[model samples]
Target: MYMALIELKDVSKLYGFGDATSVALEEVNLAIEQGECVAVMGPSGSGKSTLMNIIGLLDRPTHGDYYLSGKHVSRLGANQRARTRRDRIGFIFQSFNLLPRLTALENVALPLLYKGRSPAKRTRKAWDMLERVGLGDRVFYYPRQLSGGQTQSVAIARALVNDPQLIIADEPTGSLDSNSSRLVMELLSEIHKTGNTVVFVTHNPELTRYATRVVYMQDGAIKYDEQTKLGEVGRYARQVMYAVPETTEEDDLAGVSAIMPVLDKRGVAADKKTKLPRRKSTSHKKRKVLKK
Candidate 1:
């Protein structure tokens, strides 16, 4: 494999200090090669999203070094990092972070504007990107006017409009219904086939099977990084029985046990809606902690 476009070497990110500190990641090393799609799977609070944010330049680590596209960014200042972000990285989220008022074309054009591109050229490029994502006819629609799948398509177009070297996605499908999720995954697979590096953090292994490589995570570290290649010829069929018992539990989540990484926010609501027994929601208010 080629030298990673994003390399994490013995990275560590800690919150708070010795007496009250929590380790998010510890000596975690990873290399994401160009043109490969690697899925990071873990549950809420497992530091998987922490790794994603660090890799995406949204946050920094407490220790260790990181090299993105050959530049050591661990020690870079905020401005330098911001410029690097605008120039090299593209992000997609499960929530479909599209501006509510901007049409699909305008939404896609926003990133190029930050890069100092002129309106005329950026619009043309954005229109092309929308068409590429199969949203040509919907370019004039606002976010609320589009379906969940279409909104995600717009978000994907926005992420690609800048032509960044790496696409960092966190739970890109966690917001959609099953059908919408399938469509988004198919679109993502097509985008990967177009030759660009992708590192997506998701809890969905059904989608991970489409990745060229899989990075299974647990307790904030990669447990199994295996090569995965599924046929694109047809979909994976699910056998179901209507008479089957309905329950809140499924074996799929067993894979994510004890890993609590990020909320995978889009799915958080649906998961709550399922009427399953789950942990009670907690407010942002922090409780007082006395010294041990």
Candidate 2:
């Protein structure tokens, strides 16, 4: 059986109380296995961000059980949740959330400071992560000095610097232009290839082409969930063609071949591709720290 990296059972989130209450999520159940790249798409007010926040441990479900790598965390106290967020999850935001005063390296290293790493060690690891994200030369550059894409890349490096098992990205490409969006998507694909579970919220259906599974939400509940053969050029081509307005048959056919070549005649199956190696769980450490 595949080990689930994230499991939400009848999860719900609400704002306010009694009649004034607003339901942001309604008994949502989801299981994301290790190494799966899941795209969560929905219209505004459909609870995509709420779900991301809940899953990222930034907020607790109003009611339900949340298991992250088999540990029940839905009821964890604020400090415990914060530690879990720091130790086990990496978050990417559409705004690229870098500290304006900090250079790329400093921003990336910020997370490690809480872990009590020496400054030199933090710098070394942050620098290595920046290099991994193709921003090694931009280490000393401030956010103001970077393009939108570069800023997002730095954010990604910061997210990965802690080597978190799960990456939660909220509309990561929403603010980028077409080319930058494509670049960010490609980078996300590379991250998924490294056996990390990635769950992202996106409005752009085109971006779902890169996902192994797509979850659609409506009215604060899951509307559809389906797995697809990613890495199949035809799949993305078909999605793009459908999204384009008033394309002719000739254009559709030509677009398919020109867009992205099929990497595998038989696309890698999710079951096979996502059989990630098990890692030690840090729940105990987090709990101990929280108890202190």
Candidate 3:
């Protein structure tokens, strides 16, 4: 049986209390399988960032359960959670989050230091990841010396340097231009293809084209969770849609027939037709709460 890479049940997050209380996430439930690229979409204050933080082990939910790779982690102590984050989760942020004073290679090597790797080994591994991300030439360049795209590439290399299985990116392309955004998204797609689970939050629906599944959120709850029909047929269709055709009618028909079987077998239509079920609150006693 297939297991979820990340799972959340009845998860909720609240801040302050009484009149000052704010509900950032309410009873949100979600599961993401390994090797899937999931894009979380929502407006500002819709709890997308909060959900990412909880998944990344930076924060704990106020209520309910969270399981990462089938291990219950919602209630783990701070130090334990920190260790889990270091070992199992990788993070990418909108601002790149690279240290201003550190070179691209040094920033990528920082995580390995916590794993007790020797300085030489850490530097070597960091160099490999930077090279993988097309930053080999900029390894010694500080963040200020690199362009915006190069900075983000370094951040991506740093995130993957630790070889974590789960990657969480929050608005990774928000600060980039169209060309830079395309580069970042393509890099993320490459990462997902390697069987690592990727979950990112984005406000742009156009970016969802690169994701296998899209989860839409509203009012701190999931409103829609649907798969993108980007199989062989869909990809071919997209290519044909963009390219001016030069083939004859018979050749086009033959090409269509060749891909029809894959489309039928994959049931692409059914996958795109998912709906979120209405959820009812089980408890009305909101005045009091127990601390986790």
What TM-scores do the predictions have? 0.79, 0.80, 0.78
Candidate 3, lDDT over the whole model: 0.77
Compute the lDDT of residue 125 as modeled in candidate 1.
Answer: 99
How large is the C-alpha RMSD of every model relative to the true structure? Answer: 10.9, 13.2, 15.0
The residue pairs found clashing in candidate 3 are none
Best by lDDT: 2
Q: Which stretches of candidate 1 lie over 4 Å from their true place?
A: 232-292
lDDT of 1 by residue, 1-292 (tens): 3457889999999999879999888888998878988877766667888898999898998999999877799989999989888888888998898999899999999999888999899999999999988899999999999999999989999998888888888989878776777777777777788888888876643455457777766667776676755431101100011101122345533433433233343333333232211122322122001100
lDDT of 3 by residue, 44-149 (tens): 6778999999999999999999998889999999999999999988999999999999899999999999889999999999999999988889899999998888
Q: Model 3, residue 161: displacement in angstroms? A: 0.5
Backbone clashes, candidate 1:
8
Q: Kindly give the stretch of ten consecutive residues in candidate 2 with the minimal lDDT sum.
A: 268-277
In what order do the candidates fall by lDDT, top score first?
A: 2, 3, 1
lDDT of all the models against the reference?
0.73, 0.78, 0.77
**Which digits, one per residue and each the tens of the lDDT, describe model 2 over residues 117-223?**
99999999999999988898999999999999999999999999899999999999878876677778788888999999899987555566678888777778987
Sort the candidates on TM-score, descending order.
2, 1, 3
